[model samples]
Target: MARAPADSHLTPQATQPGGHVPVMLAEVLDALQPADGGIYLDATFGLGGYAKGILDSAACTVWGLDRDPQAIARGQAMTEAEDGRLHLAEGRFGALDRVLEERGVAPVDGIAFDLGVSSPQLDVAERGFSFRFDGPLDMRMGSDGPTAADVVNELAEGDLARIVRDYGEEKKARRVARAITQARGDKPIQRTGELAEIVRGAVGHARGKAKAHEIDPATRTFQAIRIYVNDELGELERGLAAAERALKPGGRLAVVSFHSLEDRAVKQFLRTRSGDVPRASRHSPDPDPADRLPEPTFRVLFRQAKKPRADEAETNPRARSARLRAAERTAAPAWANFEEGRA
Candidate 1:
């Protein structure tokens, strides 16, 4: 998983399926260093962007996994057309090992997860992922997921406040949660506009308190609701742990996260697993090489996470938030700073 020399390694092939140009494409190829005849896993195969790139970079086989049936419907065609070299499965990325085993596939040479909602999902009004287009209050990534409406109507007031503050980092969480609880009591807030208006009314004066902020005051609240309903953080913790076990020695693990919340988890996971101590604390003993921990089970591939280059930013604005980090599997499994409930 050490960084590849340059973008030349990806080779110029048609990886941009139907104008769905992926962000930080060159950087991903450079980090992954995909080799010919390798088998890789695209753990979050959103519209097959990264999966297609991996397949084209070499004669490599790819296993794409996603919980959304719509994505699977688009990707199954690739598997069919490629004569099964490209396989798509419908499941959570956290269940990586089980799906691979069921497919009779062995541990792969590399695994990558692109953590973000797809363009199609956000652009489609009926999907309810974006506030730009009003629709039902349904922000579930999976077709069969518990929609945002279900969560807003069902979760207790204390739980709702906690979710908004923890996931969204919104200071006025109590106000918004309480407002929603009272509003929904009058009638079900089934539409996106209704909920957005409710959130706006709840936090009417707080909007002027923060600078460097853009978009409606409701953005953070919506994000919190979506994260809670999807159980995204829980999925990430489980998925990362699973990916660690599913790679062979020297196998690469790369993740491109779209926000600080996700980046913190990915960065900390690699750094902590490297057996590097979190910044020295007041409570503990001094340093020791023996205390330095056993040879780390995974070798960190990047000294720091990679950000989008200038040129790529112009082509795709989404690249702005992306932070890609990678690591390589080393010796036998050694449990390190990886936590039981990082989410």
Candidate 2:
């Protein structure tokens, strides 16, 4: 399938009415050229941004999936408004293929994923996705998992350190972990404010002469806890593979990620699937020829990730770090399910 032009446009109305702009909206629409009669999946249907945009663009069908039951409930009115064109399902995108199959849906024409926490999730203090708020330290994207409070209060210091270091890319992960353990020992660190204060107190001193624009010291730690609570990276790995399996031949896959880790995963997946493997590093041994990968199943749409326009970034602070990468599916069969070590 041919890629839609990079300059494909979207009007302001395409965004949800309440100013909830989906990051990289135009670029995503360009990647997934929604056409009449086509079926599309908004894999992370947070606030129904991309799903609403796709519905507005064509007479297509959209299955919007979100693990958060609150999100699904909120979208019911919009689903009814769309007159059967839009369907809302409460489930993780990681199991999108199964969700569709259970509903007797066929392969989709396009799939769009807007990864990471949503504005609603972050803005609502009770949800505990951001350090800015001081509500309960619950960060589970879905209803069932252990909350962020549980993670900080129960995990070994070493385990907490590893999560912060690996997931948040915090250089002083050990220090942060130590502080959390020490603080929680006094009493369970149950609130977002308490945790944020603990993290700030631990690392704020290290930022001796912080620049005016520097982010809060607690940002990384909060992000780390939220990611851990949600198992987000693992879900992305599984979701991407699910998208590959769910799309029909020539189907499009568009993903918008807000940070480097998520973008890196999407980049590596597309590069490897499109047969653009990187040269083996001299320090590493070559892989066995007998363990070759399956045939290419996707054609990468862009050599580099698409970033939000300067104007858009300026207007929407959340769009600043967003990066979009897209690809088109091929006739080749989907590869084996994603394994942790493989990605």
Candidate 3:
């Protein structure tokens, strides 16, 4: 890591000497296939984990994006370590096009996105992403904006219920919302455990001392709050579009998403191949066939999703949740929002 410049506002966590356990190394590299002198995009530059691997494996230029200012600080160090081949952009992955524009970047050779929160975001209690640690309900991934507490303590009961039901896919959203409403009457839901306990109590009929779920009972609720707090799904939509615009002809796009919701969004986005309408429904108006078409933008490299080997899964349990998908761009001119169905 390079020495920090003066006037740095980065936290100790950003400067902390820790290596992130990358989720899927072999699959990411195999799919992206970064070539020497190629420009690639790392849409989610958490901890610079994938960036490190890409830099080491290929003589490519990696332009990385992340919402966390802290991540950008760390990435500044990493770029220095890589002799300035890595470009760190302080923004959400959804804004890939704008960031690239400011950097004078044209179409890129490849794009890699690791969807969902990073380990550091969850492990740190003060960040408030996990219920395991009792901290203030502040689940912002960037740690510089509206938090889970604001949602829990401020959203209307109906909206809260919807958040739990839709984002979380939790069945007991009504009861959970009711519990939150009542709890706030006595005292605000100020901490993660307080909210987690309220969720557990609301599901008294389903709670098992053994295990409410293979995961935590509050996992779904927490996920719902975090999703709303960060507008994760919306960012995903914009990121997909931006990536489509960024890829060069025959360029690759690889994404490793951790859950079904994210995987489904990616699955549909890739299936639709961004900037093209879904053939699933032809009722939507289409441009006249008389007009010249831009040509197909991408073709699927693999018909099926890829998973890590058993050996790899054993070594990194996190890889189990990873579902990788890849595609190569064609000559198409990137119209926009291919996965309109997801929106």
Candidate 4:
């Protein structure tokens, strides 16, 4: 995953099953450097975008995993079409290590994760991931988890405020949470539209303006609730650890994150695993020789994370916020406490 000699290396947006044009496709392929006869894993496998690119890049085998049953079902066609080169699994990416072990597939040559809700999920009104779409207040990535509606109706105002404040980084979390609690007391906030309206009312819009609000008022609240209900940030943390354990020495790991929360976690994970010490106080004691850490388990592929090029971002607005961080695994064992590091 060391930076190779620069090349354009861009691939045309080959339409995938769910119409997703994988964000930062060129950057991911470049960082991964997929080789012939290699075995790789697509930890997100949303619409088989990156997975398909990996397979098409070389004579390799790909194991694609996804928690959403719908994604898995759609990817089945991809598996059959690949004629034994593609394998699809239905499960959380956090369980990648266990899933690989159970399937007798470990120490893979590479792994890729496209973090956040997929385009298909957001586009479908029934999935209820977007504030733009009016539908049921269900944001669970998996079928079994508690829905966003459940959290809105059941969680205490303090807890809800914390979710918005911490997860969404919304400044007006307290007000929004109080509004939700008050509204839900009369009846459950069962629809996305209802919740959106409540959030808007609580936040307020520009005076004398009716049609255009500065960004959707519900955006932050909805994002916070969706992340909380799905435990997305938690899943990402675990998934990164699992990837560390699953990759072979020299294996590549590429992650595409859509927001600061996710990008920060990835940045910290890679930096710590690569043995970069966090800035310390001058008063800190000298390190003990016996307490010296083991050799780094990974080497970051780039000094800075890659973002979508201007043209790509222009073509797909969703790609605007995407950030990609990648690394090459080392022979050293994965750290047991990656979470305690900077992120």
Candidate 3 TM-score, C-alpha based: 0.86
Tell me each candidate's RMSD, in Å, in order. 4.1, 3.4, 6.9, 3.1
- Show model 1 residue runs off by greater than 4 Å: 1-15, 205-213, 278-295, 334-343
Candidate 4: what lDDT?
A: 0.85
lDDT value, residue 145 of candidate 4: 75
- Candidate 4: regions farther than 4 A off: 1-12, 206-214, 279-284, 288-291, 341-343
lDDT order of candidates, top first = 2, 4, 1, 3
Task: Supply candidate 1's per-residue lDDT for 100.
Answer: 87
Expressed as tens digits, the lDDT of each residue in 238-302 for candidate 1 is 78878877888888888888877888888777776666655568686786654445456678887
Query: Which pairs of residues clash in candidate 1, taking residues 3 or more apart in a chain or in different chains?
Result: none
CA lDDT for candidate 3? 0.77
lDDT scores of the candidates, listed in order: 0.78, 0.86, 0.77, 0.85
lDDT of 4 by residue, 1-343 (tens): 1112134233444455555688887778888888888999999987888888888777899999999999999888888899999998999999999999999989899999999898888988899888788999899888997899999999999999999999888889999999999998898999899999999898887576667325677888888998999899899989988999999999999999988999999998788889887645679887665556666899998979888889877888888889999999999988765354422
- Candidate 3 Cα misplacement greater than 4 A, ranges: 1-17, 205-213, 274-295, 337-343
Model 3: ten consecutive residues of lowest lDDT: 1-10
| Cα lDDT over the full model 2 | 0.86
In the range 158-225, model 3's lDDT, one tens digit per residue, is: 99999999999999999999999999989888899999999988865444466522666688899888
Pairs of residues clashing in candidate 3: 275-336, 275-338, 297-330
Residue pairs with clashing backbones, model 4: none
Name the regions of candidate 2 deviating beyond 4 angstroms: 1-9, 12-14, 205-212, 279-289, 337-343
